[model samples]
Every structure is written in C-alpha cells, then in structure tokens.
Target: MTSPPRRLPGEGTAHTVEQSAGELARLAMARMDETLGWYRELSAAQRSQVGLVAQAGISQFVEWLRQRERHAPSAISIFANAPQELTRAVSLRHTLDLVRTVVDVVEARATSLAGPGDEQLVLESVLRFSREIAFAAAEVYAGAAEARGAWDARLEALVVDAVLRGEADDSMQSRAAALGWDDVAGVTFVVGRAPLAASSPDAPAATVDSLRRAARHLGVEALAIVQRDRLIAIVGGTRDPLPVVEHVADRFGPGPVVVGPTVPHLFAAGRSARAALSGLTAAVAWPGAPRVVESDELLPERALAGDLPARRRLLDRAHRPLTESAQSSQSPLLETATAYFEHGGSLEASARALFVHPNTVRYRLARITDVTGYDLTRPRDAWAVRVAVTLGRLGGTGATPGPAVGLSDAGQPAPVGRRGLEESSNL
Candidate 1:
C-alpha cells in the first residue's frame, strides 16, 4: 500500500473474530465439496441406478451430522421419511452396498490416522462420515415408506376407476408388468368395507395387511391397498383362485364380503373389482345368501358358455309360465328349472331349494314345455333350457325344467336328445 492502513474502533478485537469466522466457512465449503466428490466417484465406478439420490444421501448425511450436533429435533423429523425415499429410488441392495463402502472408507482412514499428529483431524472426519451415513439411511428408509404409501393410493384409484368404467388403465397394466407379474392370466379384487370396531385388537385394515403378508409367505405375489374408506387387494397369476378367495373371505369375517370371477388379464382386474361391487350389490339386494357372485355362476350356462340361442330358448321357457298361464306362478318354476339344469338335472337338490316335494319337482319339470313350448327333459333342449333359466333369473324369470329321467351313474344326465333315459330314481 502507498500509505499505512487506517484502523477503526475495535479493529484489533474484531479482526480476530472475522478471521476465525472466515476460516470456519472455508472449511465447511471444502468439506461439502469433498463429500459430493466421493459420491460422484462411487456413482461413476458402479453405474448405480439412482446417482442423484445417492448424491442427495451424501449431502443430507452431512447436514444431519451438523443438525444432530446442534441438537435439532425438528430437522431430524424433516428427514424421517428420507430413508424410505432413498431405498425406493436406489434400491435396498444398493443402499447396503453404499453403507459398506462408507464403512470401508472409514476403516482405511482410521488405519492411516494412527500417527500422533493426525489423531484429532481423523477423529473429526470419522465422526462426520458416520453421522452422514446414518442420515442417509434414515432418508432412504423414509423414501421407501413413502413409495409404498403412494403405490397403495395409485392402486386404489386404478381399481376404483376400472370398476366403475368396466375397464382397466394401461398405466396399471404397465406397473404390474414392471413388478414382475407376467403370468397375470386373470385378476380379482377384494374389498373389506365393514368398519372394524375401534376397540378391536385385530381391525379390518390390520387384517388386510396380515393377509398380504400371508400371501407373500405362501409365495402368492399380490398387492394390498388401503384406502381412506376401504381395504382393496388384487390377486392373480395362480393356477387356482378359489383358495385365495376363501382366504380373503375368512380374513374379512364370514360376514358380508364380495368376490368377483376370474377375468382375462391384468386389465380385467377391474372387471373382477366390479364383480365384487356387484356381489356387494346383490348381497344387499338379497340378504343372507352367499356373498360370492361369479359372472358365470349367476348368469346362465349359455351366457357364460357364450351360447345366445340356448339363452333365448331358456329365457322363453322360463318366462312362458308367467305370461302363458295366469294361474301358474312362473317364478318358482323358473327357480326350480334353473337349479335343476344348473345341477345338470339333479331333482332332489332343486326340489329342496324350491321347498317342494320331488314329485312336485317332476310334475313341474313336465310342465315347462306346456308353458314355454320347450321340452325340459329332452337332450336337444338342455342348452336352451339352461340359457332360458339364466336369462329368467337375471330378467326375473324362473328355473329351467328338471331332467326327464334320473341322472346317469356319473351324476350328469345325457344331453337333451338321444337319451337312453337314465334311470329316473325317485327324488
């Protein structure tokens, strides 16, 4: 300088304070750059799935260490969800690997710091690194938990939308595919709506989670979604569906629960969901019956088997009693006919269901054609009879006619025509 520098009041005391603050700031900046550099190096070497998350974990770890030293409880809460997030983005496997890497680095640094002169610096750096690791883990855990919550929400929305519209979204199909659900031949959704008691130890929502765990334990891959108002789940890719259905029913309590039929693919999950919806609807419409409403089970054989003419004929037979004869109550006749044909012409059971004697059932059978003009006991009339019964039930018609003769030795009577009449055992 051309001249001596002028000093202000308290210049001597303030100089020392300014110098110390500046030094600490520089050190903090340097440490941050170093931490970031380490993450970049690791990312480059491993080609990790989420480099950004990894870097964020590193930065967050440093911040966590600082906050913890300052005793910041609020800051810890802010990062409580971070661990799950990190796990979701980078995967649990990678997180563990990164943790291992941090451990190894710390160990190597400790070994190098054995000399007397470097002890304090080594100790400080080790503590900082350890704190960072802990925070990163916390964040990753938080992230994973968050992802699960989001998945639950999305799944519910997709299911409800598909059910209401009678179709599935492409995004849901893709998400299922991403989760390795390739063998998704069909889909079925189950919901538990009854409000669990507040005091109950095992609530409905808790039961849903338990069932999900049970499915996983049994190696049945599935998704359990908990919504604000309901519990929903989708089960698929198995050779058998009944066992799973029964399992869910058992969980929700043998009370009012609904199950849909097996549909084509992941896209058909909604169809099943809607079926569950229908099952609930039907259960409400007709109380104290089976809560299950399979599309094929409730609809006529032809409708399920896709035989339109047979359905028309069965419907014609079922309704003929109601319209053709003012004296005849077509409702009971249709119910009996449906049960008889559905049971493949088992009179005893059909009679029992209709609360009529077996012979009364037999007389009713002989009268199907009299009312509908379609022979109930004929081989050619079987499909038509079945279809009519299904349409009748759905359209408020009655059952198909009973078999003319008794069932064969195998229990199934021969088809409508050319029957060497199997022995007609008294019902």
Candidate 2:
C-alpha cells in the first residue's frame, strides 16, 4: 500500500503501546461501572464499609491522572472532549483499587464469624460485614435502572439483618443491666436441652420450625438458639416459672425437660438453668417416665438416692436403712424389728400397725438385737429405725409417690402425700 509511507520501527512500537493503554483504560472504565452497580445492592453498613475504600481508591486515581497529565500525548485530547468516557476511566481505576481492600475485609470477617468470643463483638462484626456486602453490591449495580429493582430488594435484606443484630444486642444489654448484673445478682439460669434425635420423617426441621411458629401462636417472643443438637431459649418478663415450664414441655415433647429457677435477673439466669439441667439429668436417670424436673426438687433425696431403683431411691435416700437386711431377712426379723422399732417400741402400737399379735411384735423387737445387734431401746437407733420405716412405707411399691416428684422448698419430700398420708399431712 505505497510502501506504508516508510514508517519507522519506533513508530509502530509507539502505536502498539497506545493501543494497549487504551484497552487497559477501557477495561478500567467497565470495572468502575460494574462497581457502581454493585454499590446500590449494598446495605447501610456495607455502604459505609465500601465508602472508606472508595475514598482511598479515588484519591489514588486522581493523583495518578494528575501526574500523567504533565506528559500526556497530544492524541489524548480526543478523550478530553469525551467527558463521559473520561469519567468512566477515572471511576473504574478507583473501584479496582477498592476491590482489593474489600476482599481482605470480607475474608477477615468470615473467619471471625465462626467463634467471635465477645458476644457483643460477634454481633457488631455481623453488622459490619452486612454493611460491606450491601455497599459492594451497590457499586456493582450502579446506574443500571432496569436492574435497580432487584438490587434494591437485596439491599433491603442486608440492611434489615444489620439493624436487627444491633437491636438484639441492645436489647440484651439493656435487659442485663436492669437485672443488677450492673449491681449484683444470684445464679443465672441457662435454659437449654440437647435436642433428641429426630423422631420421624421431616421431624428435625419440622419440629424446630413448628416450635418457633408456635411461640408466635402463644404470643411469646424469645430467642431460639440451636447449638450442639440442642435448642436453647432465653425467656424474660415472666415471674411465673410453672406456666412457662408447662408450655415448653407441651410444645417440645416430654423428653427430660427442666426449668431453672428464676434468678434475680437475666445475667444470673444462665447459671440457674445449668443447675436445673443437672437436676433434670439426675431425675431422668432415676427411673419412671419422662418427667419435667427442677433443681430444688431433687436436693432432699439426692444424698442416698444415687443407685436405688426408682421406687426405693427416694425412700432410701431420704432416711436411713429401712428395707430388710440380708441376715435379718432369713428370719423375717429385720422387717419385723424395723416395724416394731418404728412404733416407738410399743408392742401394742407395732402390732396394730402391722396387723400382727402384740406377742409377735414383742418377739420381733427381741430378734432385732439378735440379728443386727441394734437395741431398739436406744433412742438414736430407734429414731433412725422409725424414720427409715416411715420412708419405706411412703415410697413403697404397688403405690405412687404422688405428683410431688420434684423437690420441696426445704429440700424435703413434698409435704403433700397421697391417701391417708396425704390427708394426714394436709391436716
């Protein structure tokens, strides 16, 4: 083509460099546009996060352009007249720089999400990341009117999550402060239980979700936390522990349920709940049906209740040895002796109580000394024998221990017994 006008080799190299630079500039502009689009999709917290990075990137890009202006080629004037193109180039360069910084922030936040030690900090970090993501997405969706609706929805979600976390934290702090953790408080109740294995098809998700839904149904607002195959909930604003315990048991099934005592406030509630759980564990292990247990209910009988079968556990632990000893059993002597001894060593009373002859009651009282070498005449051992026998009769088999399965206020058997015992106790 006319010898190509005899162009120099250096001219070809310069032209190639200009073309490469223009392509880089175009790519930078595209990135800026994409970033702006992403920004609109971000939440308030996310916008704040990206805003810092955006400022730094913009500053660097401006300084770079100013430096380049001193040596800019004459042909670059063409872009000068194209303000839109120039603006896009500047925006893109800034966004690219910010993206690098944002990546680092996101990674750090994700890492900390697993085990953020301070509860408050954990909440704050969630808010911070939410903000970052919202802002980044907004940058990506910037100036795209047709797709703006979709980005707006996403941004709304991000903002909601950020705000919700902050509210939850503030609410927690306020509740804590009021409970006198700000001053002082007693044991904390940490109410929780390990979730049982899913019972049926669709039960796992269905059970948990149903419980959450039911809280609303019951007009109860509380936090539901799932941890280690367990659902833990903290409830505030109620002094009546019984109703809540009943309500939860009714909802969650009867598997070893426990309700901790209401402490002075929320701060101490965690400890109280843990203690209550321990009692529930012991009760479930004790025997009988799945029962809702309480900490205070078990304290009286815990001492000797350790390994006895359910029927015998409460009686045996609450008193001294009541049942027949092995040697005394050979002669029916210990049982007879205990009965007579429990009758205040009164032959007539012991006979009437046992539906036996007074002679037989006296004869057994004599054998008590022979079999175990315990003189029923001694006041202390006689008292022990009396209490033990009473407990045995109270907790005897072929009978129910009444509905008083839990601890009494004084760490004693619940004052209310059944039948004659119940009637007499009531009197």
**Candidate topping lDDT:** 1
Positional deviation of residue 318's Cα in model 1 after best superposition, in angstroms? 11
lDDT of 1 by residue, 151-238 (tens): 6535544444444344446765565555555456766666555344412434533655676777766656666544333455677666
- The true-versus-predicted C-alpha distance at residue 102 of model 2, in Å, is 35
Question: What TM-score against the true fold does each predicted structure earn?
Answer: 0.50, 0.31
Compared with the true structure, all predictions reach lDDT values of 0.49, 0.42
Q: Model 2, 270: alpha-carbon shift in Å?
A: 3.3
Alpha-carbon lDDT of model 1: 0.49
Candidate 2 global CA lDDT score = 0.42
Candidate 2: list runs displaced more than 4 Å.
1-209, 250-254, 300-427
Candidate 1, position 21, lDDT: 36
